[model samples]
Structure formats: C-alpha cells, structure tokens
Target: MLIVCHPVLYSAVVILRMVDRKLSEIAYSIRESFHDSGYTEIFPPAFLKSDKVDGFRFIYRNKIFVLEPDITLRLMNRHITENSKIYYISQQSDEYLNESLKAGSEIMGGDEDETNIEILRMAIKILDNLGIKNYNIDISLTGIFDSYVRKKDGQHLIRAVKSRNYPQIQDMEIDDKDKLLQIMDTRTRKSGIDKLDSIIERIDDPRIIIDLGTVRQPEYYNGLIFEIYGKQEFLGGGGNYIMKNLRGCGFSLDLQALSKLYHGSHERVEK
Candidate 1:
C-alpha cells in the first residue's frame, strides 16, 4: 500500500507528530533553564549493575525490556564547588508504568536527549524561549513504591490503583515544625532521628540541622536534607546519600502539575 495516499491515517500521523513536536519543545525549555543556572550537564548511564538497581523505590527488572546486561547511560556527577550547581535533563523511566492505564502498551519509554548532546544543548535553548519557570508546584509521581503494600497470593501488590502512590509532596504546604514531625511519626517510626544525629556529628556545619520533623519517606534518606512547602505541599526537595558515593541536593519543579492544581485540575506531570 502506498502510505502517503491514505488520508485518514495520514491525518492521524500528522496530529501525533504535531503533538510530539510541541511536547519536545516544552521538554527542551525545561532543559535550557538548567544551563542558565550554571549547571554542567552530565550524561549518566541509564543502565547499572543489577545489584545497584535492586531495592529501588522505582522500576524493577521484570517489567523492563532487557536487551543488554548493562544499563544505558549509567550515570552520576560531582560538584566543582562546595555547592556547585549542576543541571541534567533527560528522559527518565517511569518504572511504575505497570501500575497505570498504559500498562498493556510496551512500557519502556524514553525522554528527549537527542542523538547527540549538541542537539540537546540547542533544544534546551528553544525550551528556555517557551516560558518554563521556577514554579512552586504540587506533583505526584506514579508507580512509586508505597511502603504500606500488601501481599496477595504471596506477591506484593499496590494497595490502591492511584491512592497516594507517591505523595503529592510538592503540593503539601507544611508550616509548623511540630506538624511536620507529626506527619513523620504518622507515616513511620523514629527511623531518621538517631541516624540523622550521627550524620550531623560528622558534618559539624552550623548551617545544617537534623530535624526529624522534616522527613520525606524514603528508605535511603539517611542524612541531611531540606525542602520548601508552599501552602499546600512540598514544592522541591532533596537530601544527602553517602552510601552510594553520592552527596548532593537538587530541586525538582512540576510546572505542568502546578498549572493543573492551581490554574485547573491537578494532572500528572512527568518528572
């Protein structure tokens, strides 16, 4: 069949391409902002040693297409300065696709990095022109492993389809230190309190405070951390991880989700 002569199919293809172009433009703008902010972009390998990916709160092995033993772009970075700001933008796997409506489709997806870093660099500039900004937003990440999971037929299953999968943490506006503490306790025990103190002792920085009250529920958050809540939920947050030979803090903005919650109805934004 001559592909170009089919009007209906051609129109569908045209619409999909147009939508993809618009989405790509938006993704590019997000990346460019990172460069303007003095971030030296690093390409980390997506694939890793099998053991490293294990016990992660996100994607698991059985769900992915395993073409190679090594993970793609397996990556990490170091700050040139004490607080050297670095920026990275690339397609990240939504490991929890198995739990969503799109589960039946081939779950493996990619984000834009282009075939070359030079192309990615140019794309970032285009995105900067498109008006993406520092947004205080509420966002939800899907397929996030909830600690309070269930075992049915000897296998763990997510408790609810979309129920609090990942806390719309960016949306939570926490004010009182005491209230944050209560939230921590309500979720889990004094898991961070003792270990946090030890991590503080090693640092001895007057600027850092080991507050049990400011905890975000992650099993690996074993040291210093921080976040800002803008009247509804955590806007942006990150913490230190020494065990992985990594030590850094980064902020994530959910502009699309923010637009939904405040300007309209909350929608899922890819992180």
Candidate 2:
C-alpha cells in the first residue's frame, strides 16, 4: 500500500525533526560542560504533591499532584550535602500550563564570594563553549532593594525603581530619595555596588553590566541576581537564595531559546 501525505505536512514534520535535533545538540553541549566542571547530574520527579498550586495541578488516582514548576525548589527539599555541585535538565510547567526546558546548575554550601564567582565563571564558560559571543549579563544585588523595602512606602518605591518610573519614585516619601534615584541610575557607588565591583574586578569581563534596578523573585532570591541575554531575548537567569536554611547559588539556561540562537548563528556562518 502506498501512503500519501500532504506536502505541507511533510515539510512540517521535517522542520520539527530539525528543531528536535538542534535542541538535543544544545542540551548535549550543556551537559558536557557541566560534567567537565565536575558537576553531577540530577533527576527530580515530574509530579509533586503539594497543597500550594504553584504549577499546573491535576488529579492522579484521586490524589492531587502538581507538575514541577521549579527544579531548584525540588532539589532544596532533598538533603543536599555541603559543597555539592549538581546539574539538571528538566521539563518545567507553570501555573498557566506553559512548559519550558531548563538546563541548570546549583552549588550548595561554599564560600559566598567563591560560590558566586564560580557560578558566574561557569555560566560564561558555557556560553563561550556554545560559541555565543554577542551577549550581556545584567547583574544586581537584591539586598539593595531589600533595604529600601524595609522603609515606609518601600514597595511602591521599589516598584518605581524597577520600572524606572522616575516621576513616581520622586513622588514617593522615602528618605534619601536622591540616593535611591542615583542607585537606580547605576551611578551610585554605594552599598551593593561594591559587591558588583568586586565580582567585576575578579571576572574582568566587560559583558557584565551592573544593573541595580533588577530585583526579580525577591522572595526567592536573597543576594546577587543575574540574567543572561542573547541578541534579542532572555536566555535564562538565576541568583543566590536560601533554601531549607541552606545557602546556595546557581544559574539556569533556557535550552530552547539557546538552541534557536546557536542554530541561527551557525546557519548564518554556513551561508
């Protein structure tokens, strides 16, 4: 029997295969880098039972289960030993049922400065290994914003700062408003800037940008935070956080986004 298929459907199938192949290559490169850096791979369960619906929830055998939204959170629940380096590639889904592929590494229990430097270096090395050169890292210290949050009308002021709403920030009644404004402008060499400067001096990478306005996941990230960006889109980001009373820092890459960038650049080079 001869099977007949539409040309469009065939073309779509071919494209899908190409995409999957490229994604696999990207994941392999990331995993190789992790292994070379002495990090062990970890596999966490896909479905978790929790009262809080942080991810897509479903009923399995009359028991409520939620799709794992955060691999880091799941790792934290485990008894991670001190100075353990672990990496993972996992499928994550959010409350809206949006799924994404993440490749991440976590360094558990090490000197804060050393751990931060090591993570940043590893992130940069992985990007370089992938031949991704045109990228910038936006670094920030959450403590800067946390200090302001303790002040009166702090939340509103912090919101203004994050959004760069200068007028709204000015209208807020916070002490040292000018200083806060300066920090927002990335002009102040105060408090948290020193930490950024120290890291910059050690890393000596011009791609690192001091961005004090970045205060993402305040409840989760306690210290330094950084995001990786390609030419037009965010690749991924991570930061220092306390989990189960343990200090840890790590970063994750959006493997799908990364594959697109890597494939596009390589295709252009070949052409």
Candidate 3:
C-alpha cells in the first residue's frame, strides 16, 4: 500500500524546518559574537520559588513555582562582581504564559557612556553577522519620561501617547502635555536628544534613530532604552536598569521573530 501526503502539509513542514535551521544559525552567531566580546555565558534556573517574580506561576507538587520571566533579573539575584560581562540564550515566559526565545548580553558596571556604546555596537554586530542590513535602533532615555509616568493619570497619558491619540492627550490635565505630544508625534525631543546624538556619533551608524516616545517598560528601565527593528517589525529591546543595587545594561533579540524576518526576506529576494 502507498501513502498519500498533502502538498500543503509537506510545504508547511519544509518551511518550518527552514525556519528552525535559521533560528539555530542566528543563535550560534549571537553566541559567537558575545563570546568574542568577552562575555561569559551563564545559565539561570527555569523555576523560581519566589512568588514576587512577575512570571508564569504554577503549582508543582503543592508548591508554587514561577517560571523565569527575565534573564537579567535572575542573573542579578546571583552574586556578580563589577564589570561582569555575561550572555544567555534562554526561553522566557511572561505573566500571560507566552514563551519567547531570546539571545541577550548584560554588562554590569562600567562608565555609562562606554558601556552603552559597547552594548549598542554588539547589537549592531549581531544584526550584521546575521546579514540583517535593513534594521534600525530606536534610542530613548527612560528618565525623560519619569516625570510624566509618576503623575496620577500617568498610565492613561502613556496609553494615549503610545497610540498617538493627540486629542486624548491634550484633554488630559498634565504639565508639559505639549512637549509630550510633540515627542509622541515627532519621536524626538531637544532635551534628551543630545545623548542619542552622542551615541550615534560614537557608533557612526546611520541606522540609529532618536525616538523619545518609546515608553515600554518605563519602570524597568531607568536610563537609555532602545528597541531594534527589522523594517518596522520589532525584534526586541533593552536598556539600563538597577537591580539588587547593581547597575546593568543589556539588550535581547527575539530569535523566533528574527528567524522569520531573515527567512522571509531571503525568500522574497529569491523570488
């Protein structure tokens, strides 16, 4: 007897395999890049006993366990000395139980400007290594938004700005509403734009963008924040944060999204 296979199913399987292979290749490139930069790879446990963690929680043998949500937080929990450069390729689950594959590196303790430039360079190199040419890094300072986020109606204001709801933002009773609106609309500000300019000058990358309205994870990031984009599709983001009284800066790339983007671009090119 002979078996019959559907053409669509077979095609889907082949595409998935190609994506898997691409993902592996990208991950290897990321690890190699970090390794050459003198970053030591560290592995953190998947499950934590702390209920305070903002991650997927489950009951295991009548005990509560939380999946590792953020690799940086987990690493901060361990003893790390000043100037510790580390990297990890890990699976992280958020509060909604959505799992994502991430390749990231963290630099603990260094001159702010030097460390930031180093991280940015590494991120750019990873993209270059993967042959992702059409990409940009949107940079912002988290502190610039601190005042607005601390307001009583801060959350609503943030939502409005993120969505570019001009009327809604104007109606809100907030100081510097005009500035906020301008930044949201233009994605640039004169106040903190100089920091971004300095970084760009040092890196000399035309793909770096000064975006003042990037407000994601405002509470988590206390300093320079950046998001990587592959032709408008979000790859991942990172910034400076203080954890366990230690200052650290890092960035993570979404391996799955990257694989899709890379393969999709190549497929289109082939066509």
Clashes within 3 Å, all models in order: 22, 0, 0
What digit string (tens of lDDT, one per residue) describes model 2 on residues 1-271? Answer: 9999999999999999988887887888888999999999999788787756478888878888888768776785587898899999999998888999999999988899999999999999888878788898888877776678998887787677766798887777888878887777773223355778898889988888887777665468878898888888789888999888889999989988887678544575796
lDDT per residue as tens, model 3, 57-174: 8887888788977777677568988899988999999889899998998898888888999999999998887778888888888766668878888888877766668788778899
Best by lDDT: 2
Where in model 3 is the C-alpha error above 4 Å? 1-8, 61-63, 163-173, 186-194, 264-271
Candidate 3, lDDT over the whole model: 0.81
lDDT tens digits, residue span 1-271, model 1? 6645589888999977755554454445555655564556654344443433422233365553311111111323222334344454333343442210000000011211111122223322322254333322111221222332223311112222222323442233323424433433332222354543443444333323333334333434433344433345333344433323433333333333322223211121423
Global fold similarity of model 3 (TM-score): 0.87
lDDT of 2 at 58: 87
- Please give the distance, in angstroms, between residue 100's alpha carbon in candidate 3 and its true position after superposition: 1.1
Q: Rank by TM-score, descending?
A: 3, 2, 1
Measured on C-alpha atoms, candidate 2 has an lDDT of 0.83
Query: Which prediction has the highest TM-score against the true structure?
Result: 3
Q: List the residue pairs that clash in candidate 2.
A: none
